[model samples]
Target: MTAMHHLTTPDGIRLAYADTGGTGRPLLALHGAFGRGRPFLSLADRLGPDWRIVAPDQRGHGRSDRAADYGREAFLADTATLVERLDLAPCVLVGHSLGGLNAFQLAARRPDLVRAFVVVDMAAELPPHDSDWLDGLPETYGSLDALRTEIEARVSLGEPLHFLEGAVETDQGWRLRWHPDDMREVKRQVFGEHWADWYASDQPALVLRGGASPIVPDDIARRMLDRPNTRLATIDDGTHDFYLTHRTRFHDAVAEFLTTL
Candidate 1:
């Protein structure tokens, strides 16, 4: 079982997280964009009682308060505060997509706080896509199904419904937990030269790639191995959201990696 908690950052944002208490090793699980802490409950259960998974609704997402700054450093600072405040330093970090990038960046700068990290389906450098998709999105949808249908039509491909996992249904209507403007800006910040950060840390690491994912290219995934003490694994039929779609397989891989530590 997981317990929910809240903390006020120096910037006064209310960050929310779920802590699955256990007698085993702690794993800080960071979800990708449009994800929240609640879903880690499924992962914690799947990993069994051998692990404590702490997942947070990052700044401007889920139950957390919105932030004016959506840059990489801002995200890093939020993760740092959660780690230090929860006394989770020297623990493992398992992040997906945007969360994965945040994990490695933190490990690079604060090795003292991170024992090891797992990057799931995220490349050091993000691939670019058109932002026109968000140009005319409505502020709210009449219902969850309505939002899903609308977003699905616009997205055309990939996991469009995944975005609804972080959506909020208020009295007004169903809307994303975060603004499209924030997501767009953050996505923009993600596309850049990050090879330096990728190679900055020598900490033990595991890079899990989705076999069917178009996010992390083969060349970059192979280059990721050049960093010392890193291993790469792939889930053959997996896609970017394989962790959710293939929980058992993802859990097995994560469990196997923990044994090495």
Candidate 2:
């Protein structure tokens, strides 16, 4: 756990973010659904002190207050606000999955705020899916073991622990901090082609895809690099969570991009 900070948006949503405190050049990182800013502290360590990493919990995840909606506009607004309020403009942006879409969308809409961006295991095209997968996910469990059991039984992730990583302990019992309905809404809005948004920004970009990802296919990953000033790298045998599982390789790729900038 590094230094934590909070921001209250114009519409009164309270957002949380983690700052790897230092005078290094700033880099704003965004996590996918069901994630928080705490994970980036380790990423800061890996990327070294040369880049000051700032990660937000986004609208309805982690310590951030839930908003009225989880649509594309809402997510992008929060990110732009964070970067501007924190004086992090012209900084490098990094995101994964849902966060990856947000990163590039923000860059597309506000290129002045982003000097460069990295999109990890996400593409402009996404197939629509239903929220039936979220049925019956309880918010609370009697204990960490209980929580683990339910998540293990119901949810599938790159790692089972990932879903549990954000679980919180409470006086009544253990519970997941994020609301299941919120996640479901986010997922519902995540689908559809975003090629226009993808090519909107001329900013330098890096696209990182897992070699074996089901979310991002080989052709789509290659298409992302079709944009000028964009670079593509695939992590061998990596999954969507390659940035976490294959951290060293992920860092090496990012570090190389940082040098280029």
Q: What is the TM-score of each predicted model, taking all chains together?
A: 0.95, 0.96
Weakest ten-residue segment in model 1 by summed lDDT: 156-165
Where is model 2 more than 4 Å wrong at Cα? Answer: none
What digit string (tens of lDDT, one per residue) describes model 2 on residues 20-64? Answer: 878889999888877776665676777788889998888888888
Q: Can you give the lDDT of residue 88 in candidate 2? A: 84
lDDT of 1 by residue, 1-261 (tens): 566799999988899998887776788988887677676567776677877789999887888998888899988999999889988888899998889999999999989889999998899887687778888889998999899998888874347645777778889999888778888877888887688989999998999988998888799898999999999999988888888777788888887887887
Q: How accurate is candidate 2 locally (lDDT)?
A: 0.84
